[model samples]
Target: MSTTPRIEVAAVADALYGKWKEERLAGRALASDPRLQTIPGQSMDEHRERVLEQLGLLVEAGAIQRAFPKHLGGSDNHGGNIAGFQELVFADPSMQIKSGVQWGLFGAAILHLGTEHHHNTWLPDVMSLKLPGAFAMTEIGHGSDVASVGTTATYDPETEEFVIHTPFKGAWKEFLGNAALHGQAAVVFAQLITNGVNHGVHAFMVPIRTPDGQMMPGIGSEDDGVKGGLNGIDNGRLHFTNVRIPRTNLLNRYGDVAADGTYSSHIESPGRRFFTMIGTLVQGRVSLDGAAVNAMKGALAIALRYGSERRQFSGADGKEVVLLDYGHYQRRLLPRLAETYAMQFADHKLLETFDEVFSGANDTDENREDLETLAAALKPLSTWAALDTLQEAREATGGAGFIAKNRLTGWRADLDIYVTFEGDNNVLLQLVGKRLLTEYAEQFKDGDVAAIAKVVAGQIGEGAARFGLRQMGQSIADLGKVARSVEGVRDPETQQALLADRVQTMVAQIAM
Candidate 1:
């Protein structure tokens, strides 16, 4: 904490929090609108039709344009934009994700990672949905391993263009949210090679579908017709057969290929340069973090309210019992309720840090790293929680929940895909785990092994104090039995430290 005024934070939080309420209202508008709701067992064409229609509704409502530049007539307030954008999950996750494919991934790739020249060249159409786009990063064989993607963007000095090609099937981009149908363009990522030097992965704007809905000459696509869920999205695959675009097509805020085809960049180290490029696109994870939390709240509000009203087996009064009155019911729901409350606070903190870094209030490299770690941490937790909460809510409502009429079953089915998008939950958590190890390893990088050992030993002693002195090894202990300091460990900051510490602890224990 800097010595910033408490009132400043609260005032900002109040305004942003109200945006979430407005987002909820947006959800209600869509849910009642019928045009946006998902129909069960809908065919691929029907799904595509509904998805395109809903995306148009979202654009017409101005719900999908919140994150653009004010010079371009957007609000340009980063925090408020995300707050409102996240509520789209309630109507349909497919709509939310396909909208994200167009705006958050594609438009943001231009807004954040592109130069003003690139923005002026392409963003007007992209922002207006006239150039609806795909984020073509996840390839068929390289889902999480972006660096290993075989799609190549080789510079051609003769044409002053970058020749991008998918020479192998494994290099073809897959599972793209809008590739099959509506996308007119894509923010394509390929390994950038210029002057015989590999410059790591970078983004390029590629026109895929023509304005008349035909695939472009060098681009080929196949629809991933039906999915386990999120069937409303036209998930598809893309292959480029020597697609050529102007060298200026590279979204080169982080790295550039000059007219001479020599690679140059602001960040020196390839590792740092790669992370910087990817970090620019991290609003994907950031939005997912907030959306997952909102989804959980939706699940809980519906289930808890319904659970309270829903009557179960008969009681002595010859009336059915409220489902929530059962201990088993509370046992199933309360822990998730606790998780949702805690995660809402965590989401706010993540949003504050995101605004701080992106708004340049705290744009230090350290702050950016912190923001990424916070996103990686909270995103995994919230997505997994959303899936778990939705499942529990579905079961809690019994067959009524299973029906589409009540919305629980549909919400459950839709949210199933969230755990896999933005990044898989397991993969995101593993990234967090790696970051934690690096943080701990830094403690000893200054030739101060004793200090690192002492720090680790000190933490172990504290853990022992809480477990041994506080609990006395008993099967049960009162919640108040521990010292206030020990219990303060439950605070979010303390929880963050322990989670990091546990990662370090596991690494250390493994090494020993």
Candidate 2:
């Protein structure tokens, strides 16, 4: 008889579902509805229209309001909102992204960056789909360098308005969702200049189109046409020419301007103020991390289910061998399965930290900084892993995976942009590396001479160990005993110590 215990499916599922089980189940139920699911072979224009209609359905279902304030008909449930939102990947990645553009980006800017007056003026319409909008932060000339964007919002004290202008073609906002057709307004990011002094990047509410879909004066838009994927989004470019809005239109939670063109902010350092404003929008990365993990789960489930049933060749007993029974197949898929589980757990932890900061339960500056760094580090890894897993799953399923109806190819195309959008993977990893160096340097900031000497001595010891000067005795004892060397690393604690030592050595070298 086999000694292994039977698996408890229900208990395992409950644990895997994390703290927000009900919200995730609700989202999954909605995603299973045919009306909201993707139609594989639809035309680009048809897909775009279908997604727009689906956004309305989401509003009717009350699926997009959980993150807003309770006074505005929302639950103020930050973590649960993301838990639910991530499940939309099952319906369609395009739909998930389009909905994110509206509620997660555009509406969130108003909620986090703007004051109560601005929220009351715009958020209700935004929640109801009465006012579709765009988040215009990336320009043709500036994608990751948001601090140096070319668009300018020059304040005019005489008329008490800000003149928003795109001085050159490079200043035009590019790749904005909803800008081509449906957007009626946009939260535009530009350098704020008042009294001939540039006060760095700030956001403002600017009308881009009329209610009936006419482009507003001084605002020009151009369609991006068919893309490699996610055609359901009406991505486009927008340019401004002397477009003017009221001074009060500035989202002034971080920084503000007076009627006489004087700039003031509670945060004195311009650099600190800019980072604080941008950090509030870190939920974009947090949500993307979860969505990518969900996508990895979907891909693995499809591939593993197919692999278990499909058979090939014959065994010695003359029965066909199931694909998954082969060691080679197991090698290919099982490690990815393990990685997907790890990513999901990491995402859950990230979501918990996010809830802590945003819910004001532990909203200290240090906690916020930790949240930002965590998101920056994890988003890149999960998204890249999702792409790798999806491709492997597709290849594992053979001819069936290539078929449109199987959803692998379409999903791969849709998720290709996730690595670059919220923040480029390379750029985000650089941020994490910088944060690591900063943390390392902080220990030496107090000029503790004794502590510095100790660290220097430790580095010298590590160098000696690396060069075999200190490990010579152990090497001589272990010579000609490869199994003994391998046995040492077989212990988990030894493996962890080696890895931790490697990281500390590399970081110390970089810091010096």
Candidate 3:
């Protein structure tokens, strides 16, 4: 007789879900809050305002301040804060993304990139939602190419302020959350010019609107209108024409300017300094990784429960079998379930590493680079996985999933843009490829020429393996007899070797 596999599901769930106890509890409470529930049939404008109200509720619950400094009435619990924030996807994706824009990007720019003066002056209003803002980094012309932005912040020595301007239409800050209507200020990124010399890119806190909702002079914006998803956010574009702010407005953790218009950075290389400033914003990607995983979990929970209780056809015993009992249905969900469990463990590890780096426990250049690379790699996978899983879950549920109240379609729609945000998936993969090559080159720096040549040959072999040319060659040598393809594919050792070999080959090709 055959026996089923024995596993401790509760133990595994607790292990994966209990990493940040207090934060997870807060998330669960928020998920269950009746006031935060999504209202069916609400218009786009109503949804946007509803999400804003939900943000206020999050502030009242003290759930959004955990990641800020402890002196500013926050817990300074970076990892826990992300863990809690990601879980809000369960309540409503629009609300989750809107809150992320408010705190993770806008507020985080001030907290992570700016100094104590900024923290003391702005964080209180930010944490309390008294001052809504946007993180305006992406430009119409320079989406992923942040370093080449055309917006300029020219230092004026006579006035001791920086004049911010969009040199052309493409230079306008585009697709900024909270920018269309709600944002009163923004952390605008522009190329810094001082003493007639360019200093790469830096962030400046610019007030865009007054408390009464009127645009400030020299600042103009237009609403993005209805988007395909995440309509709860007031996405918009911003343009500046000689908008001047005090020189002290620069978030100068990495680069600074003097009263005499002398620009200096602690890191001598402008390229390195720019990267360091951008690295501080890695928390956005980290939080997205966790959120994608949880979204997969939420969708799976609904689908699997419905499948177990649902029956379609009658069996030999004159009773209908549960939908999950069908082999095709099992194939659709069981593998996904296994992958989701793996992602849960992987996401927890990523969150822990993020906390270690941000909390100053393991802060180092190598660790930060590792954290950034891991986030880049994992966010793409998890977000892609989420969209795929939600789509499959929707199909599996048949007409039930189509109903708006079931949330499958909503989940899929809200998550679609995740592939394009924080960092575009393709762009992020390119970063990973570059980093791998850099590390690989460093390892062989002192090696013999013969050894390096041998490594190059081995990489070629990997590429050859991917093409199945080796198998064809063996078949020719064997006089039309080839090895069993299924047997080779089923071998675990062979599968691992094939995957590793293929990845190495792709990276090598990209490097060339």
Candidate 4:
């Protein structure tokens, strides 16, 4: 492939890229730090403690402080922060995710969704790891469907508070990363009801632990315990029953309820308001996408390195075949190598778009929507790619890969959840397809038959060219043989045009 894109194992210029360097350096520090290593038996209690200790090391190093406000001791280079945050997957996926719980999910919810008052009250402690928290949004039965979560925050004008309740068992938030341990609080999501009208799911900073460190009243929690991997995080479930807090507890950027139980907001459209509130934290998806891409690169690097060095067969005396030289091995790896490259290129573009939307560089509704869709589209692809790459790399290593000492198997096992945990791959892709469909339908919203006709005619013309209706045979047909076509594809512009054209053609066909 002439037009090859390169994925970064160590990227430059991205805000997250610089943070990756810091993480690399920090990872080195934890290399000898005993607390960073996973325990053999891997019980929840034992693992959570080790991770907490490791968090202290990370915080002391000021690693997670990179993308926040400088006044709060953060570097505030939003994009670069995530770039580095993702590289932690190399050292340990557990560390990467646990740190994400603290910073990416928990901290981001506060940073993006909360007001300055909320920031002043909560950020410093949270940023310093003095107050670890959970992003309690994913209910057990409503993981992807946030709109219909069974929890509620009913406004009480009598006390100027919102009483949070998990009205149904299904509303008990589950699989929360920090809930079982380390977290002292959570940014809980619940249906916002004021004056008897539901305003949809909204977030609230609810304390789960007291100052002396006890689980708060009416807050029930249970550890999710161990299974496949990423055991370092204390995945858990939380349920709220009559959890009452001040009305200000609501992270009311998009909407707010008054002491009189009256509701009003800058965004009048409830759907847009909800999306706007949620879109503020799209960085979680962006960062995850980048990290997943990095994981793929790491697997490829280790696999490619070992492949080059640890040869199998011989074409000559005492010469084992360099794995890359074998067409079979290259066929197995090279296309994925190309795909990883595409994901990397696409993710960088998406992250840039995310920064543009979130960092106030060009924060428009359209840009925010674009960023969210891009994140949803690519995160699943990259994460699934990482898991596959890791598994393939592990398999390539044969017996050596099976042993935990090589790290690939361990990484592979840990990454297994990536496919399902973050918004689930199929559901996420469905969202992407819907977005594309929405965009397509808008083109015909005016009932413009001419426009529809124009598109159909263009698609038919393109299809004809592709299948040789326009030419006697084919435009480049028999220019030579396979070798001739290969040579033509070798030109970067040719490859890029062909690639871009294929996407357009496919979409047009699907739309029709």
Candidate 5:
């Protein structure tokens, strides 16, 4: 009798669906609805308008309110909120990102950075789609270095207001989602200058347009015309020429300015305060990570299904072979399929950490730092993997994948920006690297030689085991022949040990 391994489909699916399975399924149902799906070949203007309409549909379906406070009509289920939000990639990446811009960035800035007054005044409108806004943080001069953005919010004690200004061309806010047309307001980030003290970067609620669609005084808007992808979002630039907003417009949860122009913050260090405020908005990266994974899943689904059915050249038996039955075809997509599963579980873990921190259940400085580092580390890998997987899947399907209707080409184009936005992938990884170094240094800071020796010894053992030294010993012990390294490499524990050792080696090298 011969034995063959069998997969439990339902069990695997349940594991992949994760803790927020119901929310993900609900999002999938919404994504599957024809009204919300993307129409290939639509012009930029048409696509933008269609996506805007879809936002209203989402509001009606009550799909955009999960992250808000329950008293304000949301369920406050932060993890579930993201799980559902990520599924929008199946419908349209543009819609997913645009919604993220509105709620996840703009409104979330107010919710997390602002006080209760700002929330009571703004979040209701935000949740209902009645007030569309832009998150004006990225300037032409600054992308990842947000703390150094050229825009300024200078205090005016005489007028009791903060005058928001883009002093130079470089300071103009660029690539904002709603600035091209629909945004009536923006959460503008700028250096807060109060009482002649430069108090680092801060967010201010600045109205850019009136209800009648006219630009507010001292505010100029320019449309960012067609680009590589996500044109469904009205990406545009905004500049402020001493635009005055009320003193109360400062979203000052982390730092605040008094009416007398005195700046005060719970965190005394300007850098720490800025990071704490920014860390509150880590949801963007969290959602993008999951969205990228979802995109990979969709692409693989299309390619794998097509490969299993679409017949190609003749096989050994002289019948036209199914594409998936070919060795090279499986080689091309199976690894990506496995990687997507890994990314899915990784994203779920990240989401759980985000919920723990945001929900205040496990909100601690250490945990917040861990969450940020985890997001920074995983987001780049997943997004880059998504692009790679999508492209490979496209190529595997041959001409059929290139066709617009199949979604591979369109998704590849749209997701091209993922690796760069929500903090550029390279920059994010640099942050992760920095954190790893900091943690590594802390272990040695206490000058415990025994502890250091143990750590070094453990790393050496791991390195030796992974690099064949221990395996060589095992082969010699078994007989005078080398053991099959491939079999050991396939073991889960061995694979993990190898990866961990590699990271340790790199970190040790850098520290030295």
Candidate 6:
């Protein structure tokens, strides 16, 4: 065996993880926070309370305030904020997720989509955990599709307030963290109607609870009890019935209403305006992508450590072989390890791109679109990989991995819903596929006859080559020609080209 194919492990790990990310990892407050430590045999209710307390601890340590404007008591470090946020999985998935719901989804919605008035009025309390809030976007009828939510916020010029209402049971905001217990307010998403003209979905600062933790007028909620996992999050559903809030409660960054109840927006196209509003909060997906990658790495670390210590069958010299030294064990873990590294690298790039857009350094329509597409693409891959890697790690560790003390199964179960959180995996990938097709079409739209012909011919040739290779592979396999089959597809370039061609062909067919 060749022993000359390795690089410096420490240096490689540092580079792959990114320097800022390494700093955040080294400086994690959760590492020393006694309150955030997991307790053995803790009840779900106890764990939920503990995790909520951990949010206050995080706020006290200023962990959740980094992404806010520097002028308003924050470091204004967007990328660093996400870098630190992702590392919380090392503490507990429930704590990480609940904190994410409070800060990333709820607080971030107001910060990004709301104007300065919303920020100055609400964000200080939000940052301090003095005002817990829910991101009321997902409804029973519309989790993946935000624009079709049945909740309505009708602007009333009579009182200069918006009347928010959930028309039916299915329109209730479902699976919302903080809505069950701690939330006093919510960045509620609803269709904005003014003067009989219904605008698309918009976020409003709606009060759900009073100072003494009682539900406000026209607000109803139910606790989602004893979920399969992530019970440390007090998930719940909320319904509104003719709830009226000040007209200024509307987070009007993208659109606004006049005192006369006239709706207006700088973005003329309703579709573009809606997308732009939604795109501003893509950091939730970006953070989830990195957090899922962190969970995968955590599981792999536990399994690898256990495997390196636990001896399996006897070796040639009558000494037992360590599980990690076996070829089968290596095969199972190494490929996934390599994949986690790849995802980490891609996630780092995604975080950087998100910061660039959000920091106003490269804020543009195209840049925002690119950031959103990158988030949609990478989130699905990392979350699905996390679940798969955790399962494999659990299996690799045998009985030890299944033990609750080891944390693998618990982490796996908690992460299971990540594939659906922020955005569902399949729906996100469909979004990515649509973006790909749209970009592909854009390339052909401005082309003259000659250029259009050239592109179409090229795509067809690529598809044909892919089809021919598959046919050749089939024929070789049918004749038992193993060597010829290997030769035909052995080149990495050939394999990649074939895969790309297949995907392109599929997208084209779907476009047609």
Best by TM-score: 5
Q: Is candidate 3 or candidate 4 better by lDDT?
A: 3
Which parts of model 3 are misplaced by more than 4 Å?
Answer: 1-4, 450-512
lDDT of each: 0.80, 0.92, 0.89, 0.79, 0.92, 0.87
Between which residue pairs do clashes occur in model 6? none
Q: Write the per-residue lDDT of candidate 3 for residues 420-511, one digit (tens) a residue.
A: 99999999988987889997777578888987887776666455545344544554566644455445556566666666666767667776
* lDDT-best of 1 and 4: 1
The 10-residue segment of model 5 with minimum total lDDT is: 463-472
User: TM per model?
Assistant: 0.88, 0.93, 0.90, 0.89, 0.95, 0.90
CA deviation > 4 Å runs, candidate 1: 1-32, 460-512
Candidate 1 vs 4: which has more TM-score:
4
Candidate 4 to native Cα RMSD, angstroms: 4.1
Residue pairs in collision within model 2? none
Which residue pairs come into collision in candidate 5?
none
Candidate order by TM-score, decreasing, is 5, 2, 6, 3, 4, 1
lDDT of 4: 0.79
Displacement of the residue 174 alpha carbon in candidate 1, Å? 0.8
The residue pairs that clash in candidate 3, if any, are: none
Task: Supply every candidate's count of residue pairs whose N, Cα or C atoms clash at under 3 angstroms.
Answer: 0, 0, 0, 9, 0, 0
In angstroms, give how far residue 111 of model 4 lies from its true place.
1.3
- In angstroms, the error of model 1 at 300 is 2.0
| Tens digits of per-residue lDDT for model 1, 298-332 | 88888899889988799899999998999999999
Give the Å error, residue 72, model 5.
0.3
TM-score for model 2? Answer: 0.93
